[model samples]
Target: MSQARPTFQPVHRTAKMPKAHTEVDPLLDALGGRGRYQLLQYFVSKIYAFTAAFQLLNFVYVARNIPHTCGQPNNISDIFTAIDDDAFTINNSDIFYDKCSIRVVANISGDAETKQLPCLYGYSFDERKELSIISDMGIVCDRAPLKGLGQTLLIVGQGVGAAVLPIFSDRFGRRPVHLISHMIVLALGVGVAFSPTFTVFLVLRLILGLFQQGIVLTDATIGIEVFPTRYRKLVAFLSNIGWCTCHLFLPLVAYLLRDYSWRILQLGCCSVSAVIILQFFFLEESLRWLVANGNPKQIKRLLKKAARISRVDYQHVLDVYDSLHSGHEQLDTKKEQEGTLSKEQADALLTEPVVHTVDDETHSLLDFIKDKRLGLNVAVLWFIWFTDSMTYFGLYFTSDALAGDRFVNVVLLIVVQMPSSVAIYYLVDSIGRKKTCIFLHLITGFGLVGATVVRELMGNTGTGAIISTAFSCFGFFGIFGAFGALFFYTPEIFPTNIRNVGLGTSSAFSRFGGMLGPFAGLLSEYVTWAPGAVFTCCCLAATAMVIVLPETKGKELPQTLSDVKGWYVTTDDKRRMDSIAKDGDADETPGQHGL
Candidate 1:
């Protein structure tokens, strides 16, 4: 009933002798295994952890030194007792002095003697209405020039450190550079703790910023490099989470320790720094840097260690490594299958792909700006960074104008920022880069606008104004949280060769913005509310300008400028060109103008 099937006779053949050498894994053979990358990422995260801990410690140190004690100083109370101070009729409730340093006192009616003085620090008191404003002259008399400079220097240092970190990371390895940064910060902490004069303390604060730059730069660079391209944003963003967390607790620290001396805060920070130094010693150098430096032995050992920790089989890891180095092994499968290969055949089959490696040599700064794309991106990032810091620090410094309860206002501001920071780390990878940036920028701009409206409505009103102020705080806080993520995003867009340079330029502009902050305050004195309006406008501009940027969500890093531009070129061609340059094999002949 069915069609007859065709039958064929099997042909007998003799088995061929196997070749002396053969390749097992071609894909793995071309490039090294994934283990090196994995280990490097792990090291990067640890570096972030240490830096985060130190940053928190710095905040804690500052909180403890606030100069307010819950109870009276022992000597004063004891001396009073010895003198039979009960003659003064001081009760226990009145005996305890509250910490009220660094407060804004409102002066009403412009009279030096008869004017009412409102204590900006009385938010915790039940009889809040008892506070009354003193005259503007009295208010002006209360604030010291040294106090202004102190605030200015603290922020300026932050700007400078962030701007220059890229250079430190690229030159010195991340671990050593961070350790040095920690030492510098620790010293600054000590200086801030013990300085008898305000001027010396302010100067030291600026110096502390220089060291802080290394902390931020090295941690960021290492963090980005260690992770897979897909996770770089997440790592960078999560790293920012530490900053937000520090901010959230800032209010609590300011409240609980507000009564203590500032020196105590610095001492606590120094203690934390010592602990961080110990934790950091166990951290390994970036495996990425080691491999890029062509340290095979170290790479293998690091990979083996990571595998052991990850609970992966050592043999399986070895197989992956073997596959990665197959080209290096130089297996001659075809010749071996036919017959044993002669020396000439072995040599011919053992061909290797050329790789261009970076040399540990100094380069000119001009080299960073050689490429147009890099230069433009750097410029764009600079504006974005400048605006970001301007809005964030500017608003925070002026919190007194918006809310009646300064402590609660600042704490609320910091708390709202934490979730936004955590969200950025989570979404940087899940959502594409461009979209995420655009969305956040838009939100920040609107948030600032919303804050302005609230500020306007709060125009000298009482309880209602206070409530509106808290809502506005929410908006301002979100803008700052977005800023933390942007710090990492700008650096990640560039190639390794120019990444540090690009980031440095951007960060420098950011510092410039910080330097200009005190000026903004001065400007506000001349034109009230103008700075806030300008900040809102800048946010809008940054948000819109971000649209012009090319999306780099999951793209592989290019080896050359042309590759980076997505110009037509194969990976092999780029590799060959790099090798020729490194080996000095190519003549120094001029190429076509465009290339």
Candidate 2:
């Protein structure tokens, strides 16, 4: 019996087609995939960008640490008064004055001791600019930790949303999940803006974070999957540009209304959220998704729309469907068995969409670490993703810590990131993913180290400020480049069934780093260079981890863990694709969808 078992045929079939002719999604590629149709869909999806830009960074001004001091009954409140009355060092570059206390006057005499007392009357804030939750809620000095808590908690909601929202996206559909998130985020933004109590505002921030992360990631997945491989970078590129555009606009809005209430800014940002409803009118569900779900009826309608938008004749595509792959035979079979059929009925049968058989097998997060190669890849990339967020949030969050004007510094941060994202889109194709990651990571580390060194050598003078700003710009540029390209790489490595979850979970892991980053920025209170130094070490460590991942550039996306487990899957899969490429309808992979 054992010997007879060996007599069976080999597992693999002989490949009859050329190796170079790999099969692709013909509907996406062959029908002018990157045409205005797909391009328009990609661009319209940027409404999420506007929401993200204003919502994500809204915390910056909302919690900005304006000038404050001890709550005296009727004495010095302004910083200038404290300096004039000899309460503080005259040109206190080091801020040697104790902000928590002030010298009091004897009944009718001169000066008294620097009495260490709390700001019991509630400290007054520099309200020349925007009124914020900080000014209203008194989240100062002792309550300063609450600022970090608020930021961290907001990311907590983001983490929860990242894990939960994508499940809805994968199970039901991307559109519904996104639309729901949009509505909730709109309501939450308004709620946070007009929140009467600090507790309510914090709670709303948490809820807002959750919905914001969900909407952005789901929209990102839809945008990416709609395009064929050749135009994928365009989607990523446009998204970054959209985010940067919003950031630039935000600063202008903040500056213009600096003397006004912060609620006005929140209302302005929420107003842009109306664009989400407009998406419902024009955006169609993914054709690939329809094919996978075996909805030939909807698939046909959407395919016709795509074809028309691409300027191709819809009837010619229909004719091809009618002529291909036992299409007429299947319709005839149904007609004979059931008696007669109408034109629409026959047409529905003509479009024999490829239906994906669901796999009973499941993938767990720990499964990412159990497979030898996959585990190692997951661990390393998770670290890279972590550092990506740390450096990103750390840079901007630390803007106030820097010597220059906060607005100009933030604007510079965004301006530098713009070119880096663009550079990576073009550069990833040339240098390969491994080198791109390592090189950019090293550059970021160098900028951190360089800034740390200059700040130490020259002290925090104007010259040192210029030098530090230059280096920080370098770090920001590198961080943006590496982070943007990594998004393309991370999802491409995971299989489709778990792709949304995988991206979501990895994002949650990145949020772990983000949650801690603001605290690192807060460390600037103790030492000027602490945040940069800590972030540099983290970036350098990530540089080493970059090499553990295999080069994925110019490769077909891995369809399953089996595809990732061994090299043979790539070779075998390509052979199978080549064999089916000659017949477009036959090329659709069995039990597979978009990939």
Candidate 3:
């Protein structure tokens, strides 16, 4: 027996293991990173942004107040007519005739006792160049509040939609949610135009707001997911430009339609939805979403299409899929060899040869809350979104009060933001997301505070007003830059699995801020400096909060909860060391694993 024994040699075999799901980034890179396919998706997403801007701000023109006076009583028609016809000849005693109340003098005597009465016959609006909801629905005087209520409810619906719709996007898919939202938005936008009553208009506006958010949230998610990390800042800048273009275009449309009915303007705005037809034909589902949600078939289909359109080798994409498929087989074989695979598991694996399931645990809002590090990140982002949105919409709502023509002031506000958006395009990639955010927040805070101080010191003179407007524009520039940066950064921080949910939640908070913005602008009516002061404080607070958040520039998009955990090293490292120690790898050092 001893003589029969022989020496044996050990052989090493190299197995091609499947890469992490996140490694799809490389696969995409090979398929031509930021290539034709990505650009096409980017442009399609921008179409939604373009139309949304028009719908979002159309209320400003549609609900503007026009010059009006109380309707004249039959008994005093001659007196009021003369007063209206000869504005200079009207005395102080005739002033009430031009207001919500009318002065009734007994017997038309010069010394007759006069009483102030509400406009009993309804208000008579002046012949103005433009018609508005104020004139059409008689939302004047006591009903003026209804105009603001419509706008507020629309924003509230946006908040609710942001909170809810993206959950479906995460669970079902981005493409279907995006397309369906666009269809609903197209329908609702037209419905808003033809609404028969003010009540119907308000309700439709609210629902329109909800679906509008769905389009926005999904489009942004798809836009970010499709492109490579290198192009995210550029993508964000282009989106801001699209938004600015719409703003510039909308005012022109409003001016041209000045003599037309609000319905005409609304219907014209709805025309932009025609782009949805093209989207249906061209837009593809997000590749990252497909990969994370365990749809290998869809991933292969999308990648192949991308390869065809992008002019990359088709076999490269197939090779990537094959690697993923091979990884699943190896995992199953090991499980079976270890006797951990049940009979049913082995049978299912044998039957479903191509389906490579990653972690099957579904995530929810609870995942965000239960995870301490993620929860902190989400809370900080919520606060930042709330404040940034509040300040942005607040400044916009108060633009008419600036020193220039109302239309010119709004256009200037939007134009000023263009430079900031361009600046952010460079700054975000250069200085990093956190620093860019902090710098922009400081600019916003300082600019707002300066405007408030100048307005207080100069006391409403023309010079003071001009200087204040400039400073406010400066603040607007900063806020717009910050807004773009936030949109770019938010998706990067959250992992692919819950990216839409995280963004949707932050947007929900921003919508709440937007809902409050009109009221914050109203604060200026009572406390002249209050809105600016409050906005400055918010900017400062957000700046401080931003310091604690992680920077995501140059990092590959995280694909799962485990990837997100790496953002906090102290916590993740401790857990990693514990797991390794329990697994009998006590000699492994943190540095060896690149922890």
Candidate 4:
């Protein structure tokens, strides 16, 4: 048998070299690797934040609590006579309640008994100061409920946008949706100023809320995407400074125009948005989105423009694009080979499929919750968003009801948020996302609790207000810092494919809290401390959840659920990728549409 076996000659072969493959990481390479393009996007995006501040907080003045009481036109001789400070007090409570019914000493059945009656004369608001919708329509007594209603509607609209618009941004494109929404906000905003009645104003405000929320979220999300990973916190901090600037500037606008109508204030705020139109000239569509959608032509044009402005070599962008295309083609070829051959044959050929990327799957809100770790993280982030919103709006709304000159005190409360951005610039990076969240939420909680205690100890005295304001200062700083860090962290944690959904969903939860804030303020009717205590507990609860959250400090931004779970690529895939990235030369026009 051995002799019968044919002698096999060793085949002499030429030693031909295998082609080296090349791969390009878009977020790490391409235009983002350069600083100037990232900064340009940041500059364009942050400007929207400034204008947005005016639209968001204009309600502070629009439905503000002016000095209003039941009109006394019939009782001419004693317009304000013997109007006991406690005339409108309810249920033997020590708190003053003058917004609704008026007290009248009457003679029923020849016996004198004080009875509460509807304000027949219509409430007369203070004419010595700024006018509002409440002033014009006399929104008092039976309409006292309407004041809080308007604010709630505005917040509800934003919640609706959060639930809906991200889907549009995902399906259509961020640029068109963002621009269109901004235009809607601007047009409706001006209409809010010229609104002839409270009904009209409320309707206009709802529409304005719908679009303005989209503008801010999309603009900020685009900024987060285009920036270098290392500087995400810094970009967020700077973007939010516009909010602080608006706070400072709004007080000055309020103080200067104390005698003006609310309409004028609304118009003034809407005008700032006109500057945003200039974005059409310079702002580039998100390159990440462009590539994902498989529009390399657009990507090439935008990247070349960005490269020119950023002083990067345009040839380098072309090289990167071509290289990525080649690698993809090579991967495709290997996939075909693997599909056709047996496992042993495939191993002899040395090939496997590529790891899944974000664009491979269809993204939706469900993706955030369907995955276990992501679901838990999303739930925790949702609670944090809810608590953050409740406390922030609670304080901003409550500041108006403080003992001192409300306008002046509101300005002071806003002044406190100014330094928070500066602190977050360092805090987020130094201590990491989880630690920063815990520390900030804890500080905010303790600050609120401190405020409640101070008010109780010192009563309504000016001294108590000062002490409480100090506590509020700490609270605002902590909450604002938390916001900046959360904005940066939330986007980084999610993959690009569903980032808009993740952020929008989180914001929707925040709006739910905001929608509840006005209702929560109603708790003060039962007991003044109830609202503060509830939100403070919420903040502390956020702290507890945050402590258990995973840290995302200086890590490569996760582009998929597997990446979030810290999975590594198989050895074969890794080696193939390396070779493809190094040696592959791609056709310039690979006609594949991205997700």
* Residue 269 accuracy (lDDT) in model 3: 81
How far does residue 159 in candidate 1 sit from its true spot (Å)?
A: 4.0
Residue 285's lDDT within candidate 1 is 61
Winner on TM-score (1 vs 4): 4
Tens-place lDDT per residue, model 3, 360-432, is 4456666766777678889999999999999988887764344456467658777789999888988998999
* Candidate achieving higher lDDT, 1 or 4: 4
By TM-score, the better pick of 1 and 3 is 3
**Residue-wise lDDT of candidate 4 within 134-198, one digit each (tens)?**
77776765676787767778888898888789878867777787888888888898888888788
lDDT of each: 0.53, 0.68, 0.77, 0.68
Best by lDDT: 3
Candidate 3 has which clashing residue pairs, if any? none
Q: Model 4 Cα displacement at 175 (Å)?
A: 1.2
TM-score for predicted model 3 compared with the true structure: 0.85
**Rank ordering of all candidates by lDDT, starting from the highest:** 3, 4, 2, 1
Name the better of 1 and 2 by lDDT.
2
Candidate 1 has its poorest 10 consecutive residues by lDDT at: 9-18
